[model samples]
Target: MSEYQKPLPIIEFQAQKEFWDGCKKHQLLIQKCRDCGEINRRSVRMLCPNCLSGNLEFIQASGKGKIYSFSTIMAYPPQGFQDDVPYVVAIIDLEEGTRFRSNIVDCDIDALKCDMDVEVVWEDITDEYALPKFRPLKQGS
Candidate 1:
């Protein structure tokens, strides 16, 4: 097996389709409710979590955030992740006032901390898809 095997996402549903489409283009898209403007950052649902509005629009995110909380996985990772055992999984608080759960890459896990600034880094795993990962923002950036 290859040392670096990336797992592909299941994009059989419409929501998955839209999300993956944006990722393929290196764009970060999030759903915002048309009625209440509540940004649904993590879960993909048909209606708004706030007002139960079925009108949700996908908008491009700024791709900037801070690590609210995180965990460093050094062992016992799931399938397709065993190759990347020492990785950071963070709940990022986006500048747009939403939170997203993503992997934190391109940095030492020991340097991670709560409220540390981070920026999105796209990992081109497949010809038709890319995963949106985050990394620590450089000083003075």
Candidate 2:
């Protein structure tokens, strides 16, 4: 997101800061389950959902995933993004076995499909904020 699409000021807390920092570094860090070694998707919690264990750590992702599901958002986006309507907003299933909601950019939106290979792309919207987006990875061409 750019300043225009996201014209509204974003409220941030400690966790969000750390998360954006990771994206700036081009590393996808999500909470990992210490009990069964599962990746925590959605949002991080103090304990693992599978085991109720408070043992969790941040793990770097491979930055590779597949589109599990998505929707074409034809309506107006946040603010600066009004020009890019009819875009793909999708849930990516990372190879490490976690799903995250992210926008699919850098490709033709109409060509999007479920299970298409994708790679992470970080959009630094502001000095303190960055949004993680995904784009379909091209095969050997």
Candidate 3:
């Protein structure tokens, strides 16, 4: 069996379609304000938070980033994610200057650092959804 393990949460929302779609193909995506050119994570609105312009775009992410901040989850997730307890949940600072909230999997969780170099990975949680996680990119994958 693969070293991966997860019991995922139920994601129900119409706005997150594009983000979910990219994950199916192992691609990370983020929102860009078509008006001011600012990047963000959640697909919340058409208006740019910075300039308040109703123009936005979803762009494919580079899948490379650094650990901006993180916390080791000691408690169980609301419904799913019991087996994966004690895992590291982190906010990654992308090279593009936006932050992504995802888990750092596939290695010792305690080994992570505040500015560690990490790469994106797509974990297929179901037929219709994939979760973007991170793995320590070793010398070779």
- Please list the C-alpha lDDT of all candidates, in the order they appear: 0.87, 0.79, 0.76
TM-score order, best first, reads 1, 2, 3
- Per-candidate clashes come to 0, 4, 0
For each candidate, give its TM-score against the true structure: 0.87, 0.80, 0.79
- After aligning candidate 3 to the native by TM-score, how far in Å is the CA of 85 from where it should be? 2.2
lDDT of 1 by residue, 68-138 (tens): 99999989998878878888888999998888999999998787899999999998876777889999999
Encode model 3's per-residue lDDT on 1-141: one tens digit a residue: 233455544456543666677788887877788767887554455566778876777787789988888899898665557766888888888888878888898877768888888999877767767788997778554
Which stretch of 10 consecutive residues in model 2 shows the poorest summed lDDT?
1-10
lDDT agreement of model 2 with the native: 0.79
Off by over 4 Å in 3: 1-15, 41-43, 75-77
Q: Model 1: which ten-residue window has the lowest total lDDT?
A: 1-10
Among residues 3 or more apart in sequence or in different chains, the pairs in candidate 3 whose N, CA or C atoms overlap within 3 Å are: none
Q: Judging by TM-score, tell me the better candidate of 1 and 2.
A: 1
Model 2 segments more than 4 A misplaced: 1-16, 76-81
